[model samples]
Target: MKRAWKVSELARAEIRHGCSSNPRSLTHFLFTLKKSANHGSVRDLNVDADTHSSSSSSFDSSALFSNISRLFTAKSPTTLSETLTEDLAQEVAQLRDALARNLHDSDEVVRVLEENCGPLLRRFAGGSAIVHLLKQLDSRPSLALEGINELISVRWLLGSSFSFYQPKDFNYACKVLNWRRKQEDCEFPMTEEEYAKGIALAGKVEKVGLAIELFSEAANKQLRTTSTYNALMTAYMFNGYAHKCESLFWALKRDPNCSPTIATYNILILVFGRLLLLDHMKLTFKEIENLNLSPNLSTYNALITGYIRAWMWDDMERTFQLMKEGPAKPSTSTYLLMLRGFAHSGNLEKMEQMYELVKDYMTQKHNPLIRTMICAYCKSSGKERIKKIEELMRHIPEEDYRPWLNVLLIRVYAEEDWIEAMEKSIDEAFERKTTVQAIGVMRSITTTYFRSKAVDRLATFIKRAESAGWRICRSLYHCKMILYASEKRLEEMESVLNEMENSNLSQSKRTLWILYKSYLSCGQRNRAAQVIGLMCKHGYEIPMTVLPS
Candidate 1:
């Protein structure tokens, strides 16, 4: 009879063979040892006819077990708890080394952690490796801040639920570690590049308050360079904090180490223009001149835009003349601004003249200028000009044409009383799912039909819009109510008002006033009082002047 081999002997033989194939397979061998210790069993072995066969097999199994034991003793822990701690330490060290190499290379750090180290750390170190890596980076302040930033961005991309560390914590760690150079030796604790990058990152994420905090920190450290100030100003501009931008601009002027660049002036001019502060725009322009700084194309564009917004045409024209004589030539934007101004003022002659000057330079096939000209022609009832505009628009690709242009064309066709053409345009816009344009066209068509007293046509168009999945806005209902009042159809007007309420569309103050007036005209005094009450319920206070005497 051949004695059965123990399960421990079989496991030892399997681990020996595995280790022989790969001498460095320490972890694999250790796992097999653990399995054998946990579930030991015996298996019968067939004895060979040769007398020496059983003895040889038993000797080989014993030697294999001895080798495995020696290998484990050399490297691995004796107990399960010790094994886990040892594995975790190895994993944390590996992660720490990988991150250290990628300290300055943020992109590489992200790639390595996500690809290689992340799984290992999660399995062995339970995600605490990330905290350890951050602390290691924190030890070296030069790379600490940037490393933390990259890790945070990576964690966000990875959708990690673990809260490791934050940029603010890194800042605190730097102070606590005394990582910053001695104040007597270094003028500023953080370098200009560090400050700029930190502030810009905050700005990129639209965290204006955080950006301001970073700027304040740099300022407190006496690191207010021109670039630092500009960065803070840019953050303010992006956040639409115009007043903050102005305050920083003046503060920059007071700083002996910093002087306002032309870019700085350009930003200030833009803010002033947007606010329609023509006086401030002009003063900033004069400051540029007084400083002997040449005004660029942007500077002139700012002045023109400010004048146009304020409706100071005379000043706008004077600035245009000055721009013509200056070294900085007007750009396409400058031409567009002038064209828009002319369009708004109903100066077709100047609009034509401006178009002729820039026609060759208008490289964009579907330019805003074309849209502006088309709108102007529609406003002026220029039927002949429509054909010319259409011909020009033909050069633009179909996709390049803005949806509003289609709405404008619909309005023009409606004004011309070409009902078939207007309906065709509406159908085409709806087919294309040009939602915004479709809504505008629907509103315009409804208004036109009401004005023409074509109630039947208006009802058909509303049905068409609804079938096409457009939410008819409150303005449309208001138009319908006004039309009903005009026709002395009190029942229809009440029905429209009830529909509006069911749609959860609140009546505007103007709508309420119109309803009140209509009720008074119909000699329904009680209903008129009810209208006033509805207005108040909707948060509109009734003025004494509007109340009945």
Candidate 2:
């Protein structure tokens, strides 16, 4: 027996209130009516029939019909016209169903929309109905692209904004490139610029697989131009596929149709430099000169970076000098590299010289550099360099309140016995809620105090950090215990464990291991056995290697 369809009470109540104002109800009602048109009886219109009919509500037929009659009579034209009347509603339903099935026939949708929908309807179409349709086809990007582009075209025909939707924004360009490769009779070929941009996006997102696919698609389509080749090579280099980049570079060089540009050689230099292949890196630079291509600022930076990484200091200096004499002068980045190189090599005087030159150009973006310079000064013996650190600290804006920088400053001040300065920095960080990322930063400060054996100070800092609402991690608590154990202050170590217990912290195997090691080191075999017993109680596996012979 064929199941007879009737209007669901939910649909009835919706229509009674004003089905024209509700799209779901309207679509449901229209779909129901269309289904009934093919049958003699409208038995039940359980709109979400697929979800099940038992959950649907029932309403008084007479009351619903009374309200619906008034609604239609009062505003028949206004309601029906605005809400996609019967004919247009059928078209939308068919299109949505077809799109859901991965059908790419946009002509019917576009035609129906262009003929029936006005500017207002077209504007709302993309965000409303089209979005729902697109959701069904997200895994199929080519279909999604077609749907979006066709709707965008409809909007253009209706005298709407032409540039409202950019296909590039969705990162679906790679899918389009792949799709184009399979099409034998190309209606419209993708340009080189589009392929280049798609490859660049792939690289930016660190998607090496997509980058390779896009490149191969372009290559198979015979659309491998210089721009596309360069983009692909860069993607490989930046994503740590240096060997692949090298192979691509050689291929580009041999390709009679395309020649390597200055940009291409720069990529090769960077690849070779990062791999610490200085001979190849230098050879690539020589090739750049041989080709009469002027080395850009990026080229020089890559070469210097390579030299620094390889610790070829003398050669790095000579290259910098040659760069200074050449057309490519040092940029802010170049000076930063020099400063960092000097800092690492303990050449404090030269580091200061480069700092002065670059400091004026340094913005908030260069905070990492400031931290590096401060660390370098702290490592040196001269107390006078403390003033240099102070000057650098002033450059960091108060509003930024970078937690990492605050913790670093605390370590510096604590090391110098400037207790007041260290406390002030800590208070500022806590009050500003900057210490929320406390684990890593707290470890840095704790490590500084532990290394100096400043037990009192370490305890005080830990107390302050906890009181300020920072979660005192197990590791931080372990640091304090280790410090006390090292001093052979067993009572204080026990007190720390009690504090942890009061805080509802549980002990782990590492905790037992630390206790066992500490007791054994202090020549207390009895205490080590107690730790092993506690491990057993906690259901932790006891390692026999820690047992006394």
Candidate 3:
């Protein structure tokens, strides 16, 4: 009692024509063929020999003849079997089977088509569809070029450019598009807006070279604007290209069309600060005054930061005083810079004074001023001051405490030989996962232990740091080598040196110098000579005293 179904003649005719005209339509034709083959009327075509013969005898000859006549009419006077040649019929059968197996496997279908009918699939399928398929497959760039060309042909310039994620792919697409434009006598000129967007994108991705090139292009085409120049200058400054940044600054200044703004001078001052060019920074500030341009709070902050970096406490205080007198009020950053300077110089009294002065003006909840006070107290040698600092630390919220501040505590305890307190501070630092500060504290503690000849404590602490998962960095290794050299443990020092060489980390000039001195102290003359050679090879100028006579 199976139900019987059939494909209508019109439907059959449409499938036939679609299949012959477009190979991509073969899949649809195969679906229809599957439905037709399932009908009871066509079951005899796939029956056993006994059922086939019996069914063939009772088969509806009239319907079969009508189908044959219709196929001939549709296919220009050819018989059905003749029109679908034996080879074509066999291929269709295989395709139907493959299609049925790969119904849900798009990748398998793509692979089959690519391997067996690549050219035919490309010819019949639309470019967008092929592009989508290729993207799904993550195919090579060459294969994607066809779709890129299609998009360019239809003037989808942005779409074509953005479809590629790889730099080379995007560049290739652009190059092809530009070539096409040239052939068509059309210019592919980027407008100011487009150039700006490209530069912004390049900057966002940290491709400084690309941003610089885009800026250069804009300049060559006279499309450079103030925003573009500022963006390029910012990129230069951030990438540590001070020479190029200064050159561009002067170039922009000479360009009468694009005038510099307050932000421009601020950036220049920041560049000088970063390079520690205090004199140039002062000159730039003087020029600002000469131009009658009023200096803002940021301008003063930059000057104060520069002076702080140079450790010029006198100049920093003078600038800070001038800032208070000027129209611009002191910001939290200005206060923090003063506190840090005082802490660095171990001036606890001045640090306390600045903290009291700026405590009211601190707008943010996370003030670095408190941390600076802790550092100053830790650096001081007075027990009463340390006691006071401990009381102050209790008042601050636990959540606001930074791990580096614990390093200062460790230093203080190490100086006093307070082994229990130092151990507790180290445990707390470990819990905070302050890798950088922990390394710093380790170096400081190692130096202190070396001076005190507390060799056992030093070794135990190093083992503890390793257990805490802190990888010994180059500086820490240098400290170890120095300690070992002082103890005349030449073999241990050599082992440390070997560890440093095996590590991927590059040693700084100072680290190399320390290693050289350690080898010389051990009386390993040949090894010391090799250390000097390495220093010279890495462009570290060797001092004459370090060089053997």
**Best prediction by TM-score:** 2
Give model 3 RMSD, 1 decimal: 28.4
Off-target runs (Cα >4 Å) in candidate 3 are 1-205, 213-223, 357-372, 387-407, 414-420, 426-549
TM-score of 1: 0.47
Ranking by TM-score: 2, 1, 3
Candidate 1, residues 261-376: lDDT per residue as tens digits? 56567668866866778888889999988977767665676677667656688888888888888787765556656765675566888988877765654544224446656667
lDDT values for all models: 0.56, 0.57, 0.53
List, residue by residue over 1-549, the lDDT tens digit for candidate 2: 111112222322333334123222111111010011222221221111111112122222211121111111121113323533454455545654543454445455445444432332333321123222222222233433344454443342212422333443333332333333333343223433345555655564456565666677767866565556666776776577888888897887787766666657766776687677999999998987897777776677768767766767888788889879988787555677777667656788999999888666665545545666776776677778768889888776776455655666676676675666767888888777765454655666667676777787888877877777775777777888888899999889878878788777887788888898888888899988998888888889877786557
Estimate the overall C-alpha local distance difference test score of candidate 3: 0.53
Candidate 3 TM-score over all chains jointly: 0.43
Which residue pairs show backbone clashes in model 1? none
Which 10 residues in a row give candidate 3 its minimum summed lDDT?
26-35
For model 3, residues 1-549, the per-residue Cα lDDT tens digits are 011112222333343333223211111000000012222111111000111112112212222221111111122122232434455444434543453455344455445544533342223221122222221222122322223343233334433534333433332223222222222231223333334444443443345665766677767866676546656766565566778888888887787765555556766886787677999999999998897777776577668666765678899889989988988676555565676567656777887777776554443222344555565677577868667677667656767656656767887877776666777877787788755335566666766776676666666766667667665666656667677788888788667656666565667888778777877877888988998999889988877887778
TM-scores of all predicted structures? 0.47, 0.48, 0.43
Instruction: Report how far residue 475 has shifted in candidate 3, in Å.
Output: 24
Clashing pairs in 2: 5-43, 5-44, 6-43, 6-44, 6-45, 7-45
lDDT of 2 at 120: 22
